[model samples]
Target: MLNVKSKLQTCLLYFYFLGGTLIIEFNNDEILFLEGETGVVGIIKVAYENKMLFIATQNNEEIVQFLEKDDLIAVSNFKKDKRAIRSQAYLTREENSPLVILNKEHPSTKRLETVLSVGDRVCLNCNITPGTHPEQDVLCSCDSLSGLEISKTETGIKLNQYFDKYTIEKF
Candidate 1:
């Protein structure tokens, strides 16, 4: 079964084509650098929230080939229209390793309006969870974690005022 799956994956490499933007998913765990792909396809980030996997292709030039994002492509999104580009707001993932989707009956899975700040930068590909630290809880999405750094504290989730990869200060 594993061999068949791997073979099938190798056959098809296309992942997402949202609003004219192409988001490629690597069939293999390791990324293959094709021509023009040396600096185009950024790292792939996966966040487990609400028992669903949220995937995003980052364009940040810092960690392109040097540090690639981990793979989360074995699973699929559950939504019919899973094209989560700038137009879309949410996406769901299969019950995979990093995430296990909750039933509709679950209160935590309920979708709600996300409050955004004036200059807050969020990943349009992933679902947004407002006012919470994603790493601290499984029911939260890392959409708001695009260019910001977050840390969990006894009081609450702390975020950096500015988008600094190295340092995170009080917001």
Candidate 2:
């Protein structure tokens, strides 16, 4: 049997167990570079060692490579449709790391709404008591903006206030 965790650590690849040869999917779920905030459809592919992802459009051919987990934004799997629901959320893991899901449109959002504030430091805790719901269990803390608005983007969590100036530390 292949060591799934070991392979993931080295390549940040996701194995979709397809019976024979493992089908490794490159997690290119987010498109970081777009013109004027327009959304772009990310290319998806299955790759193996020595074989990279390739695509051919009507007039262009492109070959792309994958990056390590640390070099990319964490992946997420939302259970609901974000477009229709307005606040759909899902959890996903990259490179065998702790799973993180967006925390929008959840009933628990009301619970966390009171705790978050502007300037207050927030940490995402994956392993809390009762691991029944990973999304609800994760925690965020901050010192200011007691009623901070929670939003989701291609990257990750988006606070209503500007977080560019503050240094965010994740555990």
Candidate 3:
């Protein structure tokens, strides 16, 4: 009995070291990804593909891909169309739209919110303001968020919070 228990413990430890951490749980229509968004809430997956991430909620799914590792400042979801579009049909439609903001605190939930808020323009890459007192660069509307100066990249907006620096692709 002692040997059996020891072997079991060893096996479990081995799996943990091997990254067999599929710490995903599902409840009804909700799926939770552990250690998600700033350790606040778990991440719910709406869709995924090779080299891509798609998160969703009740309405839409935001699609994004990996760029450079360092350029990635944080990943959050906002319940709004961060992009502006010129469409007469959309302008004529009157609806109450609520914005959901995702941060590190609740990564999973925020990711799901972002997925559901997918549109033509979604904020992906972020950066630190870099000064005596630094702040986060806002999610830009530009196609890519990589460059030396924040203004040069696109979307001159800056966020008021710090973001997660983990690379999803590294996982």
Candidate 4:
């Protein structure tokens, strides 16, 4: 019995070690992609407790991906998407999460290009509730060399710099 218990403990420890110890921190508005994907898969919207909410684009439709901390890591020989984890829980929750389509092209692509070109930093802080048309959202101001603050609401997107606010109707 003692030998059996010892073996079980050793196995558990081995699995734990194999799981991975590297922890990743995600900031709001940060883009995440799968291992070999070039297009934007999702953007970090909120990080709470041990979970994160992503404004993800799937098949050109907007959806939400709620993932736990362990989801980001690889545990077995199975191939895993880098930032997009495919855990059992993730699969279970997929059916309940509804997909919302953005009428126009998402602004992230253009904004990212502009930011990369001018060397400006853009970040977002949002609060979203699943299954709501326009979830309660708050995008805090960004501090960058250019002092540009950009935020996206359901119907409109806003950009504010030095007290001048620019609002685009949509997209």
State the lDDT of candidate 1 residue by residue for 1-171, as single tens digits.
Answer: 011122223334333324533333342222221111111111112323333333221221121111112322211122211222111211222223122233334465445222111111223123433323222122222333332323222222233333212111111
TM-score of each: 0.19, 0.21, 0.19, 0.18
Candidate 4 lDDT, 54-149, residue by residue in tens: 333334545454543222211010123222322322332333333232222455322321011000113222122112222213212122212323
Q: What is the lDDT of residue 132 in candidate 1?
A: 31
Off by over 4 Å in 1: 1-68, 71-78, 85-131, 136-171
Backbone N/Cα/C clashes per model: 1, 13, 15, 0
**lDDT (0 to 1) per candidate:** 0.24, 0.24, 0.22, 0.24
Per-residue lDDT tens digits of candidate 2, residues 1-171?
Answer: 433322223234333333332232233342211001111111111112232222222234332433222222211112211221111111112122232222345455443321111111122322332112232212332223223333332223334433222111111
In model 2, where do residues sit more than 4 Å from their true spots? 1-93, 98-133, 136-138, 155-157, 162-164, 167-171
Pairs that collide, model 4: none
Q: Which 10-residue window in model 4 sums to the lowest lDDT?
A: 112-121
Query: Which one wins on TM-score?
Result: 2
Model 1 residue 20 distance off true place after TM-score fit, in angstroms: 40
**Candidate 4 global Cα RMSD:** 20.1
Error of 3 at 14 (Å): 16
Off by over 4 Å in 4: 1-22, 37-40, 47-171
CA displacement after TM-score superposition, residue 162 of candidate 3 (Å): 24
User: How many Å off is the CA of 147 in candidate 4?
Assistant: 40
Candidate no. 3 TM-score: 0.19
